[model samples]
Target: MCVMSRRGRFQRGEGRHLCNLSGPPSGGSASPGSFLPLRGIDLKKGGRVKKPGRKALVSKDPYLRLLVKTYKTLARRTSSAFNRTVLKRLLMPRRFKAPISLSKLIKHMKGRENTTAVVVGTVTGTLLYRDMMMYVSTESRRSSDSAGEDDLRVNEVPKLSVCALRITRTAQARLLKAGGEVLTFDELVARSPTGSKCTLLRGATKAREAEKHFGKAPGTPGSSTKPYVRSKGRKFEKARGRRKSCGFKV
Candidate 1:
């Protein structure tokens, strides 16, 4: 028969549900009851069946119960540790989720390369630029009294056309509003007018200055001279300082 106590429900982390007392009161000589409130701990209809690591005692104190749980967890981890078999398993992390598959991507790429005969192809067509440099590789064959004199020849790689990347007007406006000043030549091509964009080499060195032309001067423009007779009030104040008013001070 299940026998639960009235005084059980130790605050969590207290005794790890370990009671200082033993099983049901019926298991003992007396009636199954306790010194505490009769709510919360439901006996298995009759009472809660005693499960593994079931409640043993109850207390409100925190530090005392924390002590018991820490020791148990420490002991479990330290036991049977540091052997070769255990070490290998511990070093490798156990994963629960499968990784994303890239094989399909590789297959698609291979199919594309076969069709185009190039490793990679871009959707945007290529663009050409002027003033770009090409290096000439000069190779000389030094014949040590042998296969005649093979003269030096210059070999150059094919002239590569550089594509200028562009930024949208909305993007440029947003960037400018965000206080972004620096932009590459390609970036300027996207947002700026052709002339302005071409002028900038690599990054934005020149910021467009705000215009200062105005229709009118800020403050009073017509007279530009001080108004007269303002000192009359000061003279009146001086005259009143000596004169007496008809009041109770008399």
Candidate 2:
């Protein structure tokens, strides 16, 4: 029977054998140096081997699965890097396919006119309410009521063509109002198989709230990482390393 040595190397009964919980094989005793190989692993290699890239989609959504299937075919048939990238992104989980706002998309597409903007994720409509209010207040302060209204109209979204996995209702309404075109992956494939004149965009991956506490520990000198705390009040995570009065501050 095979055994493991102190250093974790497999041995031919040189070390303590595994308990004979089920006794030997039904036919006869196991050979002295024999070892059962693990499925999908090579004992000679000492570890499991796997192919790179996702083998299959993990999501059960029918629409998402269909999109992946289409992209997979495109990636295999076409030599376009865009198709390959889209296929890879399609296979990713929801978190990695971050949601982007329309404002950010307009900003990125500023100088690239008459090209399709492609995103392998959802497109959100507007900024948060607080930000929207702030924007309106600032615009109102800049000019008279009539002039401000005209300025707002002039700053309208340009005619654009966008393709994404999903789009929020407000975003779609805004796009349609501006005479822009919203497209799906299949439609985009039919239009431009090689992805010519298409610009790829993605949301900020580190913009998630959970990412705020991922860097250096909170209270560490020169570290801006946020601490996971229940509250910001005086009683919660505000003493010791957080304040100079309670022991030395970091």
Best by lDDT: 2
Taking all chains together, each candidate's TM-score versus the true structure is 0.12, 0.72
lDDT of 1: 0.28
Q: All candidates' lDDT scores?
A: 0.28, 0.79
What tens-digit string does per-residue lDDT give for candidate 1 at 34-146? 43332234333455556543232143445424423432333355552212222222222222111211222222333232221111101121121223324323332345225
**Residue 227 shift from truth in candidate 1, angstroms:** 99
Candidate 1, residue 108: how far the Cα is off, in Å: 78
lDDT of 2 by residue, 116-153 (tens): 99999999987424334434556554675655343342
For model 2, what is the error of residue 51's alpha carbon versus the real structure, in angstroms, after optimal superposition?
6.6
Clashing pairs in 1: 18-57, 19-56, 19-57, 43-47, 43-48, 44-47, 44-48, 167-190
lDDT at 156, model 2: 66
